[model samples]
Structure formats: C-alpha cells, structure tokens
Target: MRYFEFILILEIGILLLLSLFGKKLLNRRIVSAFVLVTLVAHYFLEGIRWQMYPTYLMAFFILLFYNHDFLRKRKWYIKTILIFCLLLLAVSGAVAKLVPVFDLPDTTSRYAVGTSNFTLEDSKRSNRKLNMKFWFPTSKIGSPDGVYSENPVQTLDGLFDMPGFVFGHLNRVETETYNNAEILNDSIKFPLVVYSHGAASSHLDNTGLLREIAGEGYVVLALDHDFSFSDYNLKKSDAMTLEYVAQKAFITDLIDKVVPNQVQDIEFILGNLPNSNYNLVDHINFEKIALMGHSLGGTTATDASFNVQGIQAIVNMDGPLNTASIEQLELPFLYMSSFSPDISDKSLEEKGLPDAMLYRRVKQWELENVYRLHDRNTIGFHWVRFRNAGHMDFTDVPFMLPIMKTDSYDEHKGHLLKSSVILDFIDIHLKNGKNYQKVKDQSLEWIK
Candidate 1:
C-alpha cells in the first residue's frame, strides 16, 4: 500500500474510534480540535481540493454526534439523522478505499519502431523531434503490461505538477523497457495508425491503447509536434537562463499557433515516410491509414484527414473541432467524448468551431458512412454513458494511477470499447466493405 492508502486507513480508524467513543468524547474541545486538524491534514495529503466540501460536512456531523448532551436534547428524528450521517461517512470512506479506481490491463510487450525530427519553418523556428515506439502482441491469450511514453515518469510528473512546467522530482523510464522487439515483425502488412497527443503532452500518453492496437496487427505511429508538448534538452548557464525561458515560451507560443497548421504537418509527416524514420515501409498498407488524437491532438487528427490523402478513417478522442477544417472534412469520422455533446459545445466555440459545424461538415463529407454515440440512445448516435468516465478517460494515465480511485474510468472497458469500435470501423471501411449494420446493431460494443 502507498502512503496515501495508509493515511486513508488511519483516517477510517479514527472515524471508527470516534463513532465508538462518542459519549466519552463529548464536551472534549481538545479532541474535537484534534479531529479538525486531522481532517485538514487529510485534505492536504490526499490532494482533495474539490472534494473537501463533503468531507467537511461529514466531519461536522461527526462532531455533532459526539456531543451527547446536545444529541440527548434533540428529538429521535435528529438522533437518527446523526446516525445516518455517521453511516454515510463510514460508507464514503470505505467506498473511497474499496473502489478500484483506474483500470489498466497488464501489458505484454513494447517496441521502439523508429525516431525522427522535423523543422518547423512556418511559425517558430525549431526542430520537431519524435521518438516513436510500437507495442505488439506476443501471445494469443495473455494480458499485456501497460506501455508508457519514452519517458513515463517524467511525463507523469509533468502532468501532475502543471502543464508545461517540468519539476526536478520527475522520473523518466528507459524507452527500451517499454519497447517490444519480438512483435516488431509480427505481421507482414499491418494496418497503419497515426496518433497525436494533447497540448503539452507527448505522444506517449496513450501507450496502453496504442500497444493494444499494435498487438492486434497494426503499425501505430506517434509523432511529437515541434515546440508543442515536447521537452528539449538544452545547456544551462548559471541555473537561471533567459535562453531557457525563451525556449519554453517559444514552444508554448508555437503550440498555440500550430493548431491550424498541424493539418499540413500531419501530411508532411505521413506523405514523407522516410522523414518519419519508421521502417515498416514494407509492412504498412499505405492505403489503409487512420488518424487519431486526444484533446488538442484530436483537432489535428480531424484537420489532417482533410489534408492527408489516402486516409480512410479518423478517430477524435474528446477533441473538439477546429472551425477551419471542420467544413472541409471528407472521410468517415468517429467522435468519442467523456461528457455529453452539450459540455463540448463551449470548447468547440472557443476554437471558433462547434459540433453543429462538425455535424454539418460531416454531412457534407457524405462519405456514405457516419456514426454517432451519445448517452441516451444505445442503438443510435448515443451509446450508454460510461458512468464515471472523466475527461482523462481517453488516455492511459488514469489506468496507471493505482491509488487514485476512479470508479468511472475502467481501463478494460475503455480499451475494449474504444479499440473494438475503432478496429471495427477501420476494418469495415479501410479493410473490409462498409458494414453500417454492425455498428447500428451495436455489435461493435461486444469485445473478446
């Protein structure tokens, strides 16, 4: 158990002790003060910033129940309410600890396929570098270990600390440790997938999902945008350097402006294969390329499909549309969101793009194939709402944070649901003939 878990258990014990000794503890201001202090400490240690409201309420009730003189004066109904509150606190604490938070499958293999860099002459002058890895299936029936970005620990530390801020405590894992060589040559010609990460996030964020796809006989290519969500190694001068700040600012500014230009970059990376350093030239079925991205990366994927020729399908995992490219889209596309379409509207508008625009644009694409999944209609565009999925549901980090209990984000469910849906769609349009009936019949939801 981690330090957090130990602390949680300790808190539960305290609550139990208070509940059992309420009569004796009544009128003891010092004990009440101790409880209050512990509660405050709990909040800080657990990082429960938003969850403090309910925690405070529970603590208040614990204090009220322990004051027996006041409880005796109250009516039976009031006493029952106090008992119920105590029960609620007990249940909440148990639920917090007992619930299996993030769902991640055991990873089986990892592979470092290739690496390359691109020079962005359009906006900020810099080299866009990428160290792409491919995780493949090694066995027919076995759970695989989860994959991470070339630098797992660093990525997590960066993600947890703040966007764009790199902390010294962050740890980075060896890329080879997450790379699987045995499965590199598993298939003669596998399906192709191009992945783009979120803003300030590296392509390594979705290693679990990427590896799962590769294991299913697909060559997944993940690229890092120059000056966007990537870390650059530079020599330092006396610890504090204007050059470092300038470099960081330059990258941040690049990501802000590059959203629109990413379409071209995607094409530049895909069309010019040799430039990408991927050696699956003989293994890739160029005609069956699929584009995918998360958050801001999702917008890139959507826009790139319009610019990148020969792409059969696209998947946008929670990325709102970029107004510039939405109207020009001309391929089969899938939009998977954690929240309902309603919540995504503001993000769409902020980007000067909205789902209404996407809907119309998709309609214009008229590829003779389109599908939607919502929270209401299971058979139509709306599928069942994944009860507890958060915005980070589409990525792999939620699965790796074992102590952070997230009941709604199930790795197996997410992996099976997302992979099965994407694979089925790609298989039908890119590899097999159109099978709208399968998607409509909800057959894609079932996964082995």
Candidate 2:
C-alpha cells in the first residue's frame, strides 16, 4: 500500500477501536470531530476506493450513534441496521486495506521505456484486423506516461458473475512507458521479442517484465488478437490453440485447425512490423527475432519458431504447447513455469479446482522442449519454475490486483528471476551475452 493509504487505514482503524472499546477515554465531541476529519481526508487526499465505502459509512454512522441519548431515541431497527452496517463495513474495510494497489519497481535497464499502438489489417487473403502494442527503448529516460490497456477486473468480469465495479479500481493501476516516446536514433539495431498473452488475457499482462526488457533496448511487440477485446472471454479460451484440441482432436486436426491461425497472427506482425512506418521499425533486426508467450501464446511463439524463418529463440511463460506446434517447432526455448503451492490453494478456493491441470500442462510442455534442448536438436532450451508463484504470477495481474496475487509469491523475486534469466538468454542468442553461464542456478534446475 502507498504511505498515505496506510496511514489513513491505520487512523481509521484506531478510531474504530476507540469507539468500540475505549468508552472511558471517549469524548463524544472529539470523536465526532475526528471521524469528520478523517472522512474529509479520505475523499480529498487519500482517494475514495470502492471497497472502502463501508469504512467511510462507518464514520458517518459513528457520528449518528456516538451520543447515547441520541441512540436511545433512534428506532430499534435503525440501531440494529447501524450495527449490521458496522459489521459489513469492517469486513470490506479489511479487504480494502489488505488488497492494496501495488507499485511496480523501477526498471534496472539504462534506456527509457516507451510504448505505441498501431492498427493494421493483413492483406494476406485471410486478412484480419490486429492491434499491435509495442514497447521499445527510447532516447530519453522517462519521457511520459503510457497506458496499460486492459484492466484485470474489467477483463475478468464476464468470465465470472461478479459485479463490474468490484474491480473498477484495478483500472487505476498504471504503467511507466511514455506513449510513443521518440525512438533512439542510433544506427545500430535492437533485437525483436514477440509476446503473446494467456487465454482470456491481454498483451498488457506482463507490463513489468516488458518494460524491464524494452528498457534494455529490445523491441517488444505484443499482438492483441481482437478476440481478447471482445466478449469471447465468456464464450471461449483466449488462446485459440487450447480451445479446439479439446481432448478429442487428432494432431492433423490441430495443425490444420488451430496452430495455423496462431501462426497467422505472428506472420501478420512480422509482415507489417518492418514496413509499418512506426519509428521503432528503424531498430528492428528481423534476423534476431525471439518469441515469448503466456499460456496459449507460448503455443503461438513455439509454432512461429518452427514455421517462420529468422526467429532466433523462444520463451514460453507457463503456456502449453499443442501437439501441432511442438511437433514442427524446435528452437532455443525457455520454459518458465510457476509451480508454486500457493497457486493451487488459490485456484481451489476461487475456482473449485485443484489446479493440478496446470501441473499436467507444464509437464507436457517441458517434456517436449527438454527433448529438443538435450538432444541438441534445437539451439538451446531452459526449464525453470517459480516455486512460490502460480500461473497468474507470470504476469502483472497479481501485482495490480493483489486479491488475485497471493501473499506467498514474492512478485518481485519471481519477476527478477524471469527478467534476468530471460534477458540473458535473449542476449546469448539474439544479441551478445557470452556470460550466459553467470545466470546458471542450482535452484532453477534446467532439463538440459
């Protein structure tokens, strides 16, 4: 929580305690004044959050009920209602304070991060509209603010039966990239990294990691399949690859059915990105392309490396590789999975499933990638799991929506590990990182 918010919650909590148990120390006039003052500060300075309405109402209730004489005159039901309201307030207030909006730590790279968006309709006969969300290194260090795109609560609302405003507050979570900041004019080019989101997720899911890597002079392009912005989340999985395979499909069906569509998404980006006239294109090194994705996006990245030419490496962030994509794709792949125990508990408590399905999916993806890495059939591959993180932990959703984030997973620790390791891998393959061995770990066991 931010400092002002912490103090506000703390003071309000103290006032509540004094009102309930410190009758001997209570001064009605002073208590009334204190409640009024706190409410004023909350609305004007601290910013009123939706979940804390109960807490705010509690202050108003205290003002109405603090006087014993006035309370004695109130109808029995009114007093009972006030009591019930306090209980409700206490519960919501606790949740509000507990699940505070978290700030992303500053990027460790030297370059400033900037983001820009462009729209294109592929002309490849099967042409489709695509939204390209790109984060690239800029000449300046912190030019301006950039939009983070999708809000987790708003994005997830249709998937669940919850009220919309319950997560409206998540929209307040922000990113540091200056929108379309001027690209650096250096003659040398930067490596390309294509990122894809999980099923029913947004390209904006991994902002912290994206910004960190982009700041280090990589051109990160995340493709937003229009389905992600539509009501498809309620109808199907975000990653089309996971939907059709459905336990009954043959590998032929998958190759002809789903993988082609994902590959099409990548091809369109690669097709338009170089000539789209965006300033960042000046720094694109097509020969150094690397693919990264979460969930089904990983499937797309894996497929692209196999089907498309010039993709140097791959990073699959906890995504399952469909039979079709894994069969033909064997590139330098990085398998980053979150096998944390906290993930299982949250999944069970929230979705009523054990999350064992995730483990199964991880094993499936790892086995394929490990085979390529160990056999030297591929360039290189690494499989590392975050023991304290869940599938959601791979992205920035947990950090923005703390309720979705668990206490056990240190978001920073997991992010740092992934960032340093992936950056090193990208550098070793796409740029220049002869020190890749320095990032070796005993804890992050590699299959090869």
Candidate 3:
C-alpha cells in the first residue's frame, strides 16, 4: 500500500462520515469546500486521476441532498448523482486494479563472506564512522533468498502526502530473491570494484546494477556514507520528518559531502579488508581495483582515484566532474554522460549541477587515455540524451516502480538504455584489460 491508496481509503471514510452526519453539517458550505479542496489536492499531488470524477459527483450529491428535504421532491437529481458517482467509482476501481503499480525484477546472490556492520573510524572527524557490507563469492553456504530494505515505502510515504497504512505496510518488507553465485571453472582472484550511490540514495538503491557487476566475477563493495544518503535519525525530528529532510538533502549539500567521504570510506574498507576475519582479501585482485558511481557518486569515483592508492581505473556514470578535483586525478578515467548539445537547453541546468562549469572543469582534466561518451555516439557513448533520462534511471528503483505502477522513470526505454550503457562502460573499463586499444580508438566529440 502507498500513500495514494491510503488517500482513497480516507476518502471512502469521509464519504461514510458525510452520510452519517449529513444533517449536522448540511448548512456548512465551509465543510463542503474543504472536502472539495482535499479531493483536488489528492488528484494533483498523488497522480490519482481516477478519483477526481467520482469526487466531483460526490460533491454534487452533497449539494443536491442538502438543499431538498424530501426524497420524492429531489428524486431525479439525487438518483442521477448517485448513479453517476457509483459508476465513476466502479470504473476508477477497475482501472486501478488493472494497471501495474510497480515493477523491478527482484534478484539476489549468495556469498560466504557477506559481512555486515563492518565499521571504520572516520579520518576527518572525531567520533565519526563508516559501515559497509561485503558480499564476496563463497562456496557451500546455506544462504536464503535476499531481501531489500523497507526504506522505499517509508521514503514514498514521507515524500508524498499519502496515508500511513500504505507506507506502514511496507516498512521493513524484504523484497529481493537471492540465488547461489554462478560458478566459474578454474576460479582465480576476481577484479575489485567500489560502488558509490547518488546522494540521498542507499546502497540497496542500485542492487540491480550491483548484482550484475558482482555476477561478472567482480567483488562489488558498496559504501554507505554516514549522514550522506543512508537513513539518518535527526535527534529532534520524528522518523517521518527526518526521512523527508534526508531525501531533500540527497541531491544538495548532503551529496557533496558524501562524495568525498565515500573515498575515505572506500580506502578504509580496502585497507581493512585484507586483514579482517572475512576472507575478502583472497577473493579480490587488489591490483585491478576500479571505482564507479552514479551522479554524485560518479564524481566521487573520479576524486577517489586520486586520493586512494592502487585504484587502476574509474568510471563516472552520468556524473559531472568537479573541476578542482579532476585536475588532481591521473588514472585512466571514463566519462559517460546522457546529455548532448542538440537536446533541450534544460539538460545541463536540470540534470544535476551546472553543465558549463562542469564542462570547463572536465576539459582541464582530459588526459590522453581518458574516454568520453555522449548522446548518439555508438562507438564510445550510449545512444541517448540527458533530456530523456531521469537522474533515477541509472538505479534499480525505476524497474520496480514501473512494475508496481508507481511513478519512477519518465520513460522505460530511456531507463533501460541508461542502465545498459552503464553496464557496458563498466565491462570495458573494469573487466577488460587496461591500456586496451578500444579507449584510444574511440572518437571524441569535444563540446565547446
């Protein structure tokens, strides 16, 4: 159940209340106006289009019934309004039932060294912390199907003006199915890749991408940036209020701080993993470590490579470069952007941050081995524009939202294209041999 569904139930309750207390509030135009306003607000705010017509009919019933005392005298108008409202309600109910509400193909895989609560001391601050979950390939383990966080429902509830029933039902619901890791013959140490999610996003937000990368014989370590994007309980606010604040800050200063902090977190994880009780060290080919992130996380990947030693390559998935940070980075880097110069001017301004500033900054950091891709560039970049892609498309939420008939991605095709491009870029840069001719052979469309 979502907040919108709760609104529907609330509306039903209101209708019942109106029936019981009609005579008491019959003369109160303010009450009627308040109901009407709430209906309109629900329609626009929750995308509950079907509810509008029925609500209008309900309003008509209240207006007509309140004026006439005898059913015999107002039989025609009363009956007509009742019939219309019932019909509209029935149709709306049918439409809601038939339409898909959410759609993310759930998947999971088992690992022996799937440790949690691996804490690291923050280098920059006192009494600070970082936590990570390492899912390394394992053998002979009785791992059940995995489950995703209940945060999404809580998040939707907080963001939308929906009811508690919808969100409360989803709180901490496990929603993923895991399978045994795919076996490989003559298994050797796998490549290591550190994953960073966008601001206000949880590590589980990109499970679809993480599982895919892990399935490809790479150890994908996702870092949870404290106070950055993961769930935070504000000392003064309630749970709902805190969630709202966290979601809003996800794209703002919260992300900016998370990006740099993620670098430190990754370095800590890597240094400690080799010596921890968990056998992650034996599974990873540390020499081939790569860093990747979506949006702000992508920027962090770029910056981390400079700060963290032994990071061979970095991939930025639709993430803009910080001009100051880019200058310091010297490793092989790949910039995968959805924007193109031909698309709407709204692209650069709306996507994440200012494009002109990012463009000028990235240009200064462009090295001979650096590869760049943008719209319609088949050889190097994915064939899509930033205008069509939402910042959320690169994650697994889009797929799930589509199935549940929730508002996730603007377009399914664009989301698929974005994910595919990101997977391919990772494959090329992380899995494939470094100094591969493909990077140099690619053409560059230098946008001024």
Candidate with best lDDT: 2
Identify the superior model by TM-score, candidate 2 or candidate 3: 2
Q: Backbone clash tally for model 3?
A: 17
Q: List candidate 2 segments past 4 Å from native.
A: 3-46, 59-69, 72-79, 97-99, 123-128, 141-167, 228-259, 340-377, 403-408
On residues 231-307, what C-alpha lDDT tens digit does candidate 3 reach at each position? 33232223134243443443334335555666666777777677777545666787778888877778778777775
Give the residue spans of candidate 3 off by over 4 A.
1-101, 105-124, 134-144, 150-186, 228-258, 345-387, 400-416, 432-448
| Cα lDDT tens digits for candidate 1, 1-448 | 2244345445534654554444344345765676677666655654332213344576665555555555444466655765676565565555443332233464333333332222323333254443344443333323322323333334434453343322211122122222333434454566688898776566666766776676566677776653323333322231122343443444334334666656666776676674444445566777788898986688788777766667888877766565445446657766665533333445434422223344333323321112222222232131223333444667765554433424434556666666666666666666665664333323123211
How does residue 254 of candidate 3 score in lDDT? Answer: 36
Global lDDT scores for all candidate models: 0.52, 0.66, 0.51
lDDT of 2: 0.66
- Clash totals, every prediction: 19, 2, 17
For 1-448, candidate 2 gives per-residue lDDT tens digits of 5554445455556655544443343677887787777677756765666777666666666777766643443466655655576577668657776656556766787788878877778777456777778888887664455645445455445322344465556545567677767777778888899987655456676889988989888889888754332432132333223432442233233334554576788887787678877767777898898999876677677777765667888898876566445445566778876653334445534432244464445345445644544465454657776655667878886666666674466777777877988888898888866745635644364544
For model 3 the TM-score comes to: 0.55
When superposed on Cα atoms, how far off is each prediction in RMSD?
Answer: 12.8, 5.2, 11.3
Model 2: pairs clashing at backbone N, Cα or C within 3 Å: 200-238, 295-319
The lDDT of model 3 is 0.51
Judge candidate 1 at residue 41 and give its lDDT.
65
